[model samples]
Target: MFREQLARDAARIQNQFDLVLGGLDDLDVTQAMAYTTQGGKRLRGFLVLESARLHDVAEDQAIWPATGIEALHAYSLVHDDLPCMDDDDLRRGKPTIHMKWDQATAVLAGDALQTLAFELCTRPEVGVAEVRAGLALTLAQASGAQGMVLGQALDIAAESAAEPLNLDEITRLQAGKTGALIEWSACAGARLAQADTTPLRQYAQALGLAFQIADDILDVEGDAQKAGKRLQKDADAGKATFVSLLGLDAAKLRAADLIEQGCAALETYGSRADTLKEAARFVIARDS
Candidate 1:
């Protein structure tokens, strides 16, 4: 049910983005924008919307701001797939921006998208300047050197190390690499609604961890066609993962436990949190 809702929301947002991109010139730029914006779970946007709804913010009030988060996410994916990072050739069952076009085009496109993300945040339709400022700060902190970039550096560093990682080290790496942006998505929504952020932050932290645990499991057991990316890459890279640290069964159990904790963190919001609660379950249960 949550996945269906997310898909619907994604489709709506994709249409909006298409409309926004219609005026762009350069073919490479247009291609890169359209390619990266294609099919995603849109979980980040959903988090933003659901977090806003928890505070009684209307959907219309949430959409434009949520689009900002989604734009940032797409920008990250483009850069992450570049030759310097994962060097991934494919994403979401489609050619990566770098692969579809060229590295130069990909780099510039990613740069443009990053700026566009901030533009969306500061748009006149995005409500007050104070809220926009808070959201933009959250996004920068999550996406920049202090957060996801640092995490990616750790991941790269771990790959070159001869020694295996301990659980704490792995946790630190994943928290920055994957968890930070996920946390930002939820936090941004809470900020937009001017809601108390303590519980939202806690829930996002747990959700991010659970999401990574599930990703680790999927790396080992997921179908390549469904996942839209290379499977068993973690094992091949000898990268430390939850399943590598703990056995697959234990990792699965840990994911479930984290999801429960995530749900518990939002208990005060009651049914307003149903989408987020279901999203937690979906993260672990997803085949892709």
Candidate 2:
């Protein structure tokens, strides 16, 4: 049931994105934007919509920020796969933006998508003026120097440092790079409805960290074909990941525990959050 709903939400969000980008000119950069945003888990957008549903917010309004998060996430990936960054040649089993187009086009597409994300967040249809402002403001903070960017910068720095990041350091880095946007997505409903976000925030904190740990586990054992990207990059680069630091058995145990904590955090929402619980469990068990 959860998988079916998640697929539905992913399709709906993609349509929302196509609607937004449909009017764009035939520039290669715009084409790249459309391409880069096409596939992936769409888990972040799902969190936005699901949390909004939990708060009784209408789907019409929730779709704005839901699409917004996905755009921002796409922008990050386009840049992350650039020559100056991870220098990856593939994403989702296809050539990356820079590979399909030029690096300049990739940069422009990523920049355009990033700005588009904030524009979507500020759409008046989302809510009242204050709510719109809050969404834009928080999105910037979550994806900016203090959040995801910080984590990215730390990751690059760690590559040339004397030693790889230890457990605490890697955890802190992932918190900013990966966890911040997730935290935002989970709390988006509370923000939209102006409800207390403590419970959702707790759920995201646990889920986000566990998500990264699961990614590390997948890196070690997942099929590259199933993952749709390169696997064992961490092992190849000698980077310290949850799997590297804790060993496979211990990392699996930690991720399972975090998933438990994430689900338990939603106890107050009862069956309304069963999908979220499933999502948490899926984080650890997914092949990709």
- Pick by lDDT: which candidate is best? 2
How would you encode candidate 1's per-residue C-alpha lDDT over 125-224 as one tens digit per residue?
7778888888788888888888888988888888889898889999998899889988988876678777789888898899899999999999999999
Model 2 scores worst on lDDT over the 10 consecutive residues at 1-10
Among all candidates shown, the one with the greatest TM-score: 2
lDDT tens digits, residue span 87-116, model 2? 889899999989989999999999999999
Q: What is the TM-score of candidate 2?
A: 0.99
On a 0 to 100 scale, what is the lDDT of residue 199 in model 2? 97
All models: lDDT?
A: 0.85, 0.94
Once superposed on the true structure, which residue ranges of model 2 sit more than 4 Å away at CA? Answer: none
Clashes by residue pair, model 1: none
- Tell how far residue 252 is off in model 2, in angstroms: 0.2
